[model samples]
Target: MKLFTCTHCGQLLYFENSQCEKCHYPLGFEPKQLQLFPLVAEADGRTYRLFGTTQPNAPTYTYCRNHADGVCNWLVPAESATQFCTACALNRTIPNLSEPEHRLRWWKLEIAKHRLVYSLLRMGLPVVSKFEDPEHGLQFDFLADASQDGGQKVMTGHDNGLITINIAEADDIEREMARKSMAEVYRTLLGHFRHEVGHYYWDQLIDNTPHLTEFRALFGDEQDDYGQALQRHYDQGAPNDWSQHFISSYASSHPWEDWAETWAHYLHILDTLQTAHAFGLSVNPAAAPAELGLQAAITEEPYEISDFNRIMQLWLPLTFTMNSLNRSMGQPDPYPFIIMPEVVDKMAFIHKVCQQAGSSAKAAC
Candidate 1:
């Protein structure tokens, strides 16, 4: 994520900052402007005006009244009719806020959602509201399906651009059980965001771009019978050859499943490498391959798809060490999925596609 600032004092701040440490300016994100503004309240009820010029003439802002009650920190655009801000507006149905525990989970969900959006926006990808584009806009639907033991709703999957997050995934025990049932080594809320985004981008890129032939060649025919593939997966299980080719066992369910799983891993590796760099680790995914090989000689460091085969070599050892460290703490491995050579190539392909798309967009602008 890019470093943000307190608009008033130019003090470095994080994306999650709601107050300026240097100038005491109350901060709020203006989603329409994609900025965090210095908020000043008018001498009236609960309304507040926005002024921050890191973007001059930024859109005016309205605080989520939940902020007054200390339940939410999200901000909505003053001109928008939506009650939730750009982040919270995606909710289809949240848990019963009447229950104190549900409210607590809601805050945690909101925080993770904001972080996920921030990363996506930083990538310069389009994030249109599903509400705005009922036909094709990207949106999320976070809902709770009877955590109280009477309801029977039991899945969280994607349908087109909408992401349905079973709120039970928010519960620690429930998520862990699902993770175990699915034989997953690692799972988290952030991972869900990355995976769901894979489905969204598949809709945005493959469905919109001229890469149909290449997509089919690499992933398989998109026109394949999806329902049949899923049903076959449930009945017969993933192909035994899944381990040699697909990133996960479930990925063998269908070519589209493979694409989404690979896409999620690409994000995971990139973000993990970024975290390594930010923390002053010696690993450099951007470095030359020969240098990486030399580093790999001493310590297995996280690698980048951009670095070619050298990356996979380094990644395996590094992730192995990472998993061992987690095991030492009596926790599951940090990266549950394997990085096969085929998956590495796909990750490289995605990195290149993103780079080309970004450059193409900028040149057109």
Candidate 2:
């Protein structure tokens, strides 16, 4: 979520930008280097070199096949034989794009998916596609509900390593209606991606691993009947004091949900704090009480920081500022949930788990 710049004209660019507006230079993201570069297409029309590179040995790259439709901006090294970049390669099924609406929805989904993948890559977590390891590799299924065609509704959930999202979630009006009906404070495509991927990572990094026992202790025994738990939750709602222990009311439904909700918020904190750091943002209210914690200086990238406390130190102030800004604009708070002691404990566990996974990846490398 950090800010990006076009290498050619220094124009500020968003992660999804395919071209620099100011200089009209074509822009592409190099995921391996976590950088946005202006591309200099070769005469052969199949390869590109990075802008401003005078070295004869500069690496060349090709766009992912998904880039043809403007749904992706990631670059794949020319030496690689894969037609897709690291992020787009995970797709198992994309919505039928013959329909105009599905095309727009799929494009939106890709933006959120790419952002999610960017965070995973930054954490040094594995990004294997289902094609690479059919049993447990990550994959996406962007599907539309078939109710109109007399089939079952496509639910947005994760199974094994496959994450299926109902394409309707990409539509703002439909998503807003769902948020209101579910009585949720926040519901977004990005949140859904983060939460579901948490389940996939649980399978990869924690299940049957040494961390399972600790996870059970913190999240309660996930062995509890999941189906019955969810049915009971829908029938009898979350406890009145659910906020004291869970990140969201839905999180109280099951131990697995609690982990996923907490994991999503952990990601929320990291990405938001990184954006704040990029802007050199700090909060220091001269008239505010010291105990209010209305002051913090974001001096380090939250993703690079190992300590959970330091992450919170930057996150709390930034959320306060974000909420205040929204209020000033007569809009709802961008972040509405509160983080109590128990929720913090859950998030701390997630932080530790990610650190362990990252270290394992590093050691193997």
Expressed as tens digits, the lDDT of each residue in 229-292 for candidate 1 is: 8899889987787777878887788878888888877767655554454444453334447544
Q: What is the C-alpha lDDT of each candidate?
A: 0.68, 0.91
Tens digits of per-residue lDDT, candidate 2, 103-127, equal 9999999999999999998888999
Task: Single out the weakest 10-residue window by summed lDDT for candidate 1.
Answer: 297-306
The TM-scores, one per candidate, come to: 0.78, 0.97
Q: In model 2, what is the error at residue 258, expressed in angstroms?
A: 0.5
What TM-score, to 2 decimals, does candidate 2 have?
Answer: 0.97
Alpha carbon deviation, residue 157, candidate 2 (Å): 0.7
TM-score of 1: 0.78
